[model samples]
Target: MKSEHTETPVTVLGLGRMGSALAGALLAAGHPTTVWNRTPGKADALVARGALRADTVADAVTASDLLVVCVLDHAAVTALLQPVAGQLAGRTLVNLTSGSPEQARETAAWAAGHGIAYLDGGIMTTPEGVGLPTSMILYSGSPEALAAHRGTLAVLGDPIDLGADAGLASLYDAGLLGLMWSVFGGWLHATALVGADGVAAGTFTPVALRWLTTVGGFLDRYAGQIDAGHYPGDDATIDVQLAAVEHLLHAGRERGVDGRLPEFHRELMAKAVAEGNGGDSYARLVDAFRRP
Candidate 1:
């Protein structure tokens, strides 16, 4: 039976791991995909998978009205697209390249000058996670462009629209990566502490995951406190958390485990208490992170 949805033609301008995954997802969704890579041989597997291989960037850009570029960096994106700028007018360009928010805004401006529709994107998953609906792909800029191609883009992942700011996708991407690393550091530290008592990481991780789910609830509550700039200590005060952190520090020291992670928390909590905010909610420590 023929599907009711029509496939949107897609052009992928890079064949790196992430780019190849993007093209592969589109092709799997039955979209006509044209792909090009700086190193031609990189497109071999994709070509074999029914993607049309483009001999040049220009050919790739002109192959479809919906163009996606995922290259090394912002410089590479600019270098590759500048020559094809004239051909991109009236077409939508979705850049999945990792870059700074400033670079995203700059690219958006460049696209606007050339009459090209632009969407800056941040792929929240690794190459292997590309086609999973659970994976999130954040996008900003050109709301119209996003609405127009959202169905095609959904094949890569769940599309999260951040509106027309253009720089928000990269900004949020950077913040999320920082959060991920912080979570990793805390998890590894906890795993080591438990392992010292002969607990296997495998055994401890499930418990840790449940604890994280509880922590997520705390975050949801704290987010409201943060936005309102009023953190009540009804649930848990900074003073209470500060005292609890000492146990973690002492436990780490006794186990010969690194104390740096807990030490940072201790420092933050201690400072908040010293400043007479001890009775405030732990979310009050957000002040510690603000620019002085």
Candidate 2:
């Protein structure tokens, strides 16, 4: 059934957790949502909630000019869409599959070859976070397509346009996930070290959050320093932090906590210092990560 008011008709081609969340958000926001899944059973709940269930992938693709695909991987995306490539011409295909930058670029090229308007997307939150205002959904490809469907897409989350390179969405997603893991590792390590002295996690986390805000400011400054290839030590010197890390190692040793994370940091800082960067800011360590 079509929406009487003609809300931008949309189809979601997967029924996994994240895909279901996306369809739910679109329906919740008044879109005429069509859904399809291989198992058929997966679409039952969505159908009960007023989503039109497409009997086949072709039906789903034909149901809307804007199709959102959130599938298992690049291979699965290929398998699902290749047969229907002809039907997809001139339509906007928003692929939210997780894959490498190269894969995304290749898919964009394939879409371009078929005369389809393609937009590669990265969902920046868990299934539970979908549709929340704070969640960011990154999109890159076919700026014209995004400009046209942005309002409809915003129902899924904040649509962050990363410009026309379809691969940039995947690249940014991978880097962002890496940043998340690094933050998690550092937070867990600190929690364990503090817990050793009987500090409750709940008590320590608020302070840690405030500290992270301050650290975020440092990152803002350091990003520019890195781009300029001139890391100033006006705020704090790598040599000073090098001396401070010894205390952390000592504390971790006394508490029987794992010291590998801090040890790695110490190694990086020491190398920078050895290379005559001791007077530079910690941002100089960015060079340590790069190959000559």
Candidate 3:
């Protein structure tokens, strides 16, 4: 019996870590993958794994109807593709580079001008996570193109279709990064605090992670309050939260932990309460963040 899968010709422009992983995943999934990179050497591993190495960007674009560009940034992607825009006509280009929402919109407009269907994507997984089912990728762009190449794209994991708006993928990426940074910052603060008690990070990590799971529920509740713009002090008011934050700051100082982070929270809450938001929900601090 014939195989159910249909092979698609995919061109991966930029053979950096992420780019190489993408091409390798395509090749592994039995697609014909064409790879091109400025350095040339970066394509060797993919070539060995059955990828066709393109000598020029134009050659890469012309070799495949579905092109995946995972360059350093929007500027690099633009610089590389601008010179070979003619060859990209009648093709679908999926850009997985990290960039601002404005950049994704601009690139979509440019691709449209060249008669190319554009899909802006954001990969949340590391290079090793490519092709794994656990990997998540945010995508927003031409629906027709996505439907046409969804199977080929699914090789990288679940391709989450946000919407037809090209900017949504980048916006999602930015929000996800903000969450990641907040978690990382909290982890660092917690680790340092435990260090003062002669505790190793390895010993404290599991406990901290358990606490994170508990706090995750709080985030779900806070999300509803934030979206509704309802600053109800049913749970805890700004004054009460500020009192707890001050206590945290005091403990941090006493233990010689990093005072800067806890102090910043305490100060922010203090200002919010002083500005007559003492009875408001902690989420009301979103207003302070918006202030200059």
Candidate 4:
């Protein structure tokens, strides 16, 4: 049986790991895919998988009305696509390049000037995760373009529309990456602490994951408190956490685990206590992160 979205032809410019994965997903979903890479050899595997290899950027751009570019950076995206601006008019260009929000806005403007429909994208998964429905691929700018190609794009991942702000996808991408790193750091620190007691990471991780699920519920509650500009300490107060953090510090110190991470938390909580905000919820710490 044929897939419903297979009719939209896709031109993929750039055949890096993620780009190759994107093209592979589109092809696997039965879309007619044309692929190109600066190093021509990169397209060989994709071509073998039934993707049409485009000899030049212009050929790639003209191959399909839905053009997806995943390149090294914003500069590379601009360098590759600027020359083919004439061919892109009336076509939709989806850029999955990693770049700043400012660069995304600039690219959206450039596309606008050329009459090209644009969607700035942030792929939330690594190359291996591409095409899985569980993976999220964020998109912003040109709601019409997103609406038109969403079915085809879904083959890459779950398409998350971040509204019409061209810069939002990149902004959210940066924030989400920072959150991932923070989670990784905390997990590693906890694993090391437990490892000192002869606990295997595998054994501790399942329990840690359950704890994270509980933490997620706290976040949902805290978000409401934050937005309301009120931090009720009904559940747990900063003063209580301040006292609890010292235990973590002592444990890390006794175990000879690096104490910097917990120390940072201690410092933040201590500062809030010193400022007479000890009765406030942990969400009150958001103030410490705001620009002074």
TM-score of each predicted structure versus truth: 0.98, 0.98, 0.93, 0.98
Per residue, candidate 1 scores C-alpha lDDT tens digits across 175-219 of: 999999999999999999999999999999999999999999999
Candidate 3 lDDT at 178 equals 94
TM-score of 3: 0.93
Q: Tell me the whole-model lDDT of each prediction, alpha carbons only.
A: 0.95, 0.95, 0.90, 0.95
lDDT of 2 at 116: 96
Candidate 4's TM-score reads 0.98
> In model 2, which runs have C-alpha deviations exceeding 4 angstroms?
1-4
Residue 98 lDDT in model 2? 94
The sequence of per-residue lDDT tens digits that candidate 2 reaches over residues 173-274 is: 999999999999999999999999999999999999999999999999999999999988999999999999999999999999999999999999999999
Report the Cα RMSD per candidate.
1.2, 1.8, 1.9, 1.2
Give me the overall lDDT of model 3: 0.90
lDDT accuracy of residue 49 in candidate 3: 84
lDDT of 4 by residue, 1-292 (tens): 9763547999999999999999999888899999999999999999999999999899999999999999999999989999999999999999999999999999999999999999999999999999999999999999999999999999999999999999999999999999999999999999999999999999999999999999999999999999999999999999999999989999999999998988888888888999999999999999888932
**Count of residue pairs whose backbone atoms collide, per candidate:** 0, 0, 0, 0
Q: After superposition, which runs of candidate 4 have C-alpha atoms over 4 Å from their true positions?
A: 3-6
Candidate 1 lDDT score relative to the true structure:
0.95
